[model samples]
Target: MRLALLSPLPPDPSRLAHHAAQFRRALNLGGIDVLTPLVGQRPLESLEAARAWVAERDWRGVDVVHAELAPGQRTVYWVLQALARLPHGPALTATVHAPPGLLGQPLHAPFAGVYHARWLPRLTRQASAWLAAPFTRHIDRRLARRLAGVLCTSDASATRLARRLGLPRERITVLPQGLPELACPPLPSGPLKLLCLSGPGQALRPLQDLVAALGQLVAQGGDDLPPWQLTLAGATAASCFEPPRHDPLTRLQADPRLKALGDRIAWQLDPDPQDLPALMAAHHLLVLPERPQPWGLGEAEPGPTAPQGACDLALAVGRPLLVAQQSGQAEQVTSGNGATYTVGDHATLLAVLQDLLTDPDRLSDWATQARRQATSRQWTQMSARYVGFFQQAVARSTRAATK
Candidate 1:
């Protein structure tokens, strides 16, 4: 079947880009015909141009149009607008990454509002008009009514969206993001190194708290504590709470204990994907301290779902993961052979770090289990699940058309 994979192409760090790349790779491996639009610089603008581009192309043979949703409030609206204009729109399927309620709030809320409160004055004003527009809810409801099928990266994301859109659970499929398989080297014997990978935004507050807790641990434990290093990767210096660019190592440098361990704490800025597997294998543990935002004022804080590419990459490399209890991916980490700590609980984080440092054998055992769990959830498998959903969506649309 010819499938037109609709999504923004590279140079951007969007989840859609990652998914598109993975899906294309998997579909090719499965010997499927996939056609992607020619993406240029400035992808969002390019998406608008795609409608006209697809119209002129030969889409008669295309069986389906699988559009990956962008991470924004007006994603559904944009998709709907594109679909309405397509001359030969095939049966449509969409993947929604963020939860539905997220569309109602300010787009900058999770991106800039939380961490970079200093930038809020300007950023909020810039994004306010877009956030105030009420058209998103209308578009969301319309997409729910029209879409042939929906996909989410996590079960919790799917369930929440299913309820919000008032769609049946069976109509929404949960397909976790796939991680590239990697060969893990033997566990390092020296100081334990922990890696934190996250976007540069308010979402990194949990990571800051964890680092502060680690400093406290170093001061309190002194000689009794095992030698360890915390490597902060994929985040910028601006996001650090401390002024003058608070990269992880810089923040911890104030503590006498941490200051003594020179070259141990490192900050890697935008390392290549090829370097990640080796980095993950070198680290004794991976920590993601992502705290969830309040879901609708009435609901209690929810538990974490599963980790995406970063955590999964660590898992594939046989590294034990440490995530916040409130992270959406916390349950996945704990269940899939990793450890968890209560949100903002530095003592618990420190204790876990210390334990892993002291007992190398235990760390190795967790790593083995983590690798085993990660291998079973490969991108090839995820693509197959997506293809099945696409087939079902086509069948359903055909039935509806006949009726």
Candidate 2:
């Protein structure tokens, strides 16, 4: 099969891009072509730029065009719709990497026509957001229906996307993200190190409660549990400590209780994507404090529907996960591999941490289980599954055209 993947390539630093490159390599039997929009040396910054770039491409004789659609990539949605409408277009499909619900953000921005537009007035954006709030889901549903088929990384995401998109669950295929073959490092001696990774643009407000719980743990001292250290690191060279006092890094840096932990709680405010493997290896556990109401949003707000790159990387590196309940990442944490805590309950989290840290044997077993699980999710296997999905998409599209 000749497959055209609409996603950025590696060296781009997007987890989606890195995965795409992996998938392409693993699908060696299939002629897979990667297409991306770049502005001179760097990635395109706007939806308009992407659309213009795509318009100039000659997608002739491709068997299928599969795009990776994330929260803000409305351009991909537009492309999917455009290609599907063509008289002799390739089969249209997309890997919806986020909850379709979050894709509505573009419609609420001040300059709604462009993705990541920064020059708009603050008041204008706020007003637009307020006005656009009610119909965001409706827009999201329409955007989702544009594709012939959808792919998701987990069953949790598939279920959520099916509901939000008003499509039958059968229409969505669940394929876990591929894991890189990473060699497990020897478990570090002394203090059990924990790592929390934040995306380049992710704010620290969502982690404030987690920070508070860690502060309480620090204040209690390590009398019952083994010594532990946390390194809150960012995915790229951008500060995650912005927008609120509810920020974890800000509280850690400012509060005396948290500061008492000193270097025990470190912050890697700027780290490149290439640094992730070393960070994962150095830490005993990977922490994901995603809540039901993520980013401090209200209960009615739409949260993420899939685990980020950190979760996959941790599993690949054979590190146990400590994720909160109801998060997509939590789905990866089986009792054999890791543990989960109630979403907003800090006390439960504290207890889970103490239990894990107190028993080194259990942590070791969990790490081993994690590595075993990751081995089964390698891209070489995942690529075969993707090929099946792509063929199915083409067959379905062909049937629809006949009708």
Q: Name the candidate that leads on TM-score.
A: 2
| Local accuracy of candidate 1 as per-residue lDDT tens digits, 1-403 | 7777766656646545665787788877666688875455233333366455445576668777777664442333344456645544677777765576323443223432432344445445445535544554555666676677887777788878877777888888877667666676667777777787654332545655776777777778787976777787663455434332224433433655545545656776556656877877777788877754432211111111113556767766677788776667775665557788886777787787777767777777787777776776677666676667778888987776678
Deviation (Å) of 370 in candidate 2 = 1.3
Q: Which ten residues in a row have the lowest lDDT in candidate 1?
A: 297-306
Off by over 4 Å in 2: 10-15, 29-60, 71-75, 101-117, 126-146, 198-208, 211-224, 235-247, 291-307, 326-328
Which pairs of residues clash in candidate 2, taking residues 3 or more apart in a chain or in different chains? none
lDDT tens digits, residue span 1-403, model 2: 7777766677765555566778778766444444443212334455465556556777776778888766555555556655654676677788775564535455434536432344555466445655665677676676566566888877787888888889889889988788887887767777888887654334455466677788777667556657788987763322433232233444445766556667778887657667778888998998887543232211111211113667888888888998877445777886478988765687898887777767789888988888888878777766677778887888987887789
**Clash totals for all candidate models:** 7, 0
Predicted structure with the largest lDDT when compared to the true one: 2
Report every candidate's CA lDDT: 0.63, 0.67
TM-score of each: 0.74, 0.77
Model 2 TM: 0.77
